[model samples]
Target: MGDLVYFLNGRKAEKIEAVTFADLRMQESDIEEILRSSIDMICDDEESMLIVGQQVKNEKNGRSDLTAIDNNGNIVLIEIKRDRKDIEGRKEAFEFQAIRYAASYATLESTEDLVKKVYAPYIEKYRSEFELGVLTSYELLIRKLNEFLRVNKAGKSFNKKQKIVLVASDFDEQTLSAVSWLNSNHVDMSCYKLTPFKVNDEIYLQTEKVLPVTNYEDYYVNLMDKSLATIVKRNKGGTRRTLPKIDSMLDWGVVKEGDVIAVKDRDNEGILLANGNIMVNDKEKSMQSWLKEIYGWSSVQTYVFAIHKESGKSLSQIREEYMTQQAMEASDDF
Candidate 1:
């Protein structure tokens, strides 16, 4: 891992030296406690996950650091290690420990068992966080979990798969190799490198996904777009163009509010609204939520799957047609 660098006072570049957990006198328990409630440190915002259990125990009585239910209806086992030796020195590999707990979670078949085994114990451990005045029975817990699954729109795909996430300050060679091999065989496993850097009295952490190299094309495009926006800000009387959103589609006359959208190859339909949420089965759901729920995909491209009932054209097609007409009207290269 490289030292994290940042601009000091927006004037000179400064290196924030990396430090081990031992140097900070922090233990694995400290990191586990912090991540239990803040799963976003490892997960992206779009991939919704709820931490239903912390220190979840397996059949062998091994306690997992965290257990979560992801939006894709997969049970997620998140295991964290403080430093490199915290993982490499173990008899059983750190990754194997997480995999064992994840396998135990796979044996669960119903939401009731989930509520009893995970959610109930989690609620017990974090009682102050909930408003359970006289509602501490299993009935209430099961009901609440069911409601959560339904409201999240994950009910249809509940327990379809299991996901494994391993986090550490640094990874060992064996751990990296195993995770890569598992991913190649279609196992939904990932690793996150969480490095801590100390700057004076303050400590900051940098997180990176080091395995299964993904395309960063969109990330770079966003950086270039930010640069263009900065140029616009500096130029007098120049304004930055915003990314096209649902409102943009309405303005471009591609689709209107209250238009019915039919999901391709599916019987599902929704009534589009100005706010970008669609009315699906008497409930307002975001276009992306509807798409993700039906497809059981981790991410969704709303416009690609949605078709305007009246025009009989997919949202992507209509958007492209509108852009083509605009380009033809302008007929000039920038």
Candidate 2:
């Protein structure tokens, strides 16, 4: 069993007593309630994520624990299993259910579709519990969704990218191996073990990511990138386009030799230095490497905005104008 024991400071190490949920009379519903109320406690990026729906129904007539959208526009499906023993007989069942929900969610075409289909039901179901005279639940939800898109500049379609989070008190070897393999292949899957411990009168919850391991996260991310690159290459006649060199960007006046540029899309972002080296989420990379790392395909273009260290223009504004100019030039060429 997963647990934590308190230690007393002394000349000799003394093992303080520790207790489990059974001793405290805590139930599965308690964990679920805590998670549902404050999901950020478990999500990887709380600032960029919005929990838009709960107990969402899948096409299979089953309910998903929670559904969220991140700033990158990736759909996040979270499933919670109260304790290690609770998943004994139904280990595969939870995985299958999460997969079904992901499959269904992958069909969503746009954020609007998500708001209308997934979030609307949640708003309506809980409308009465919210405060009035301010924004209505529906309006508040839309504002939150739009704000996320505006801040992230994530344009709609999250169907292609999905993240599945499986939370349980403990995961057996079988489930851990399965999720680890899936994460390495192409699925962005994570398993979190939430263990509860009690000492005296206080209860402490410990959450650990048991799958993929924290140190190996980048390795799995690279593997998934390679897999996606392969898929993109295969789908596009097995040819990968070369990204434009830094000189071209400089000549086009999009970026100067010493300027820092942020290349972004609805789901990801990469930073390019004036010296031609690129960085995605702080990891140094080359242009082609960053493109492949971010979008899986070089031909898949995204918004590139020059960051002016001394200017008042926002990155989003810069990106918007750049896109507008590109659209106009494309129209003229057409």
Q: List model 1 lDDT by residue over 1-334, tens digit each.
A: 4446674767877766688878999999988887775566676534556677888888789998888887667898888999888887899988778888888998989988898888898888777766677776577677766755664578988888998989888876667667767776788887787888887888787876665434212112232244532332233221111226677889876788899999866788999998878998899998876875775433344565688999888787888888898888888654
lDDT of each: 0.74, 0.61
Model 2 reaches what TM-score against the true structure? 0.59
In candidate 2, which residue ranges exceed 4 Å CA deviation? Answer: 5-19, 45-47, 128-136, 214-334
TM-score for each model: 0.65, 0.59
Q: Model 2, range 167-254, lDDT digits (tens) per residue?
A: 8876655565567567667788877777776656667777655555433332223432445323222332111112344555556675
Off by over 4 Å in 1: 137-140, 214-334
Per-residue error for 306 in candidate 1, Å, reads: 18
The 10-residue segment of model 1 with minimum total lDDT is: 232-241
